[model samples]
Target: MRRLIFWTTVVSGIAAAYLLYKKGVPPGTIASEVIANPVGTLIHEL
Candidate 1:
């Protein structure tokens, strides 16, 4: 259960970074935002 959340967050972060990068969002900015709020970013993306 715990590991699930961890992996989910990891995949979510990677997906977010990919999408943002495709959209021309700066990598540095995406790194901070995704690192700062993985769950929130995932939920918001949903």
Candidate 2:
């Protein structure tokens, strides 16, 4: 349902923000890194 999709998006966005915070990177920087290699970005995040 639409409500479920909206909630999922919101939760995922929050999770991503937390991950970026922990990694000491901004969301915008992560987004740009993702453009090069998503896997590398994830590894760097971890």
Candidate 3:
């Protein structure tokens, strides 16, 4: 059960990273967006 959770997290993280890369979004940009406007970002995304 724990192993399943671990692998699922790992796979999803890799997939997210790949998608972000394809979209040309830099990691620093994402970090700054979250840090600068967490609530606004969440609302906009939703």
Each model's TM-score, in the order given?
A: 0.81, 0.57, 0.59
For each candidate, the alpha-carbon lDDT, in order, equals: 0.82, 0.62, 0.60
| Candidate whose lDDT is highest | 1
lDDT of 1 by residue, 1-46 (tens): 9999899999888877777777798888889989998767667666
Write down the TM-score for model 2: 0.57
Q: Write the per-residue lDDT of candidate 2 for residues 17-44, one digit (tens) a residue.
A: 5677687887687666555554444455
TM-score preference between candidates 1 and 2, better one: 1
RMSD of each: 1.4, 5.2, 6.3
1 or 3, greater by lDDT? 1
Point to the candidate with the largest TM-score: 1
